[model samples]
Target: MTVDYSLPKPELGAPVRVSPFIRFCRWGLLFAGIAYGMKRQRTLEQRETAHRANLRAQKVIWDEEQKKIATQRTREQLLQLAKDVNVPIPADFDTQYPPA
Candidate 1:
């Protein structure tokens, strides 16, 4: 006689049974997960906001520096042009474009 070794086929219409303890904790687990997610999301949003603010402040400082540099260059160029043409520098020229 031959021995049977094949596993039985699963029934498609069988109902799944959940443990009572797990079912009792389902709502608590869902709420805890949601609470944790919200806390993490809030932390991330705060960090991103702080980073953006830092970038904005840096940009403002950078723009101000660029403007200052441009102003200085323009002043120097004007002074040089006046000297090349043998024009006397106005008394207030130094006051307006104080030495770099």
Candidate 2:
């Protein structure tokens, strides 16, 4: 039996070359994805900032409301004290006097 030691020759044809247009399209798609990601990040940051501002505004409003409530309570107590001392109840005092 004769042993074959010769290697098979490779087939020759036009070299496999990537088209420039295809390369351009790939690069364009990559850049478009980066731009989209950057835009999305900016939008999210803006939304977060706006949300924080809204929360701060709400806190300020709540603090003001608390102050107003405290002031009303103090006024009511003063009016009650005046009544207890036999002082004349002013007609303009609109708060309902508590039962003794």
Candidate 3:
């Protein structure tokens, strides 16, 4: 038995063209992907906005609570907490709660 180590040669044929249906499918897939990406981006942006607004609302509530506590009692700790949380204490704070 003789063994042949020769490689097969490449063959060239007529050029092939894409079918109309396949081209249409390709464009359809591209548009679908773009639409999905836009939808996902909008969803994520809306979620982020809601999250920020929620955080702002929580901070406002916390600030108000601190100020309320400070107003109820002219204690040093509560007053400090309100000042730090609300920033530039309200003008009435000085007149209403004199330092001890």
Relative to the true structure, candidate 3 reaches a TM of 0.47
Measured by TM-score, how close is model 1 to the native structure?
0.51
Q: Residue by residue across 29-94, what tens digits does model 1's lDDT show?
A: 999999999999999999999999999999999999998898899898998999999999999998
lDDT of 2 by residue, 23-53 (tens): 9999999999999999999999999999999
Q: TM-score for all predictions?
A: 0.51, 0.44, 0.47
- As a whole number from 0 to 100, the lDDT of residue 70 in candidate 3 is 73
Model 1: CA > 4 A from native: 1-13, 25-27, 71-99
Residue 75's C-alpha lDDT in candidate 1?
93
Clashing pairs in 1: none
Per-model CA lDDT versus the true structure: 0.93, 0.86, 0.85
Better of 1 and 3 by TM-score: 1
Let me know the TM-score candidate 2 reaches against the reference structure. Answer: 0.44
Candidate 3 Cα outliers beyond 4 Å, as residue runs = 1-14, 62-100
Write down the worst ten-residue block by lDDT for model 1: 10-19
> For residues 1-100, what per-residue lDDT tens digits would candidate 3 score against the true structure?
9999998988989999999999999999999999999999999999999999999999999999888777667656657797789866777865767763
Candidate 2 residue 39 C-alpha distance from true site, Å: 1.7
Strongest candidate by lDDT:
1
Q: After superposition, how far is residue 42 of candidate 1 from its true place, in Å?
A: 1.2
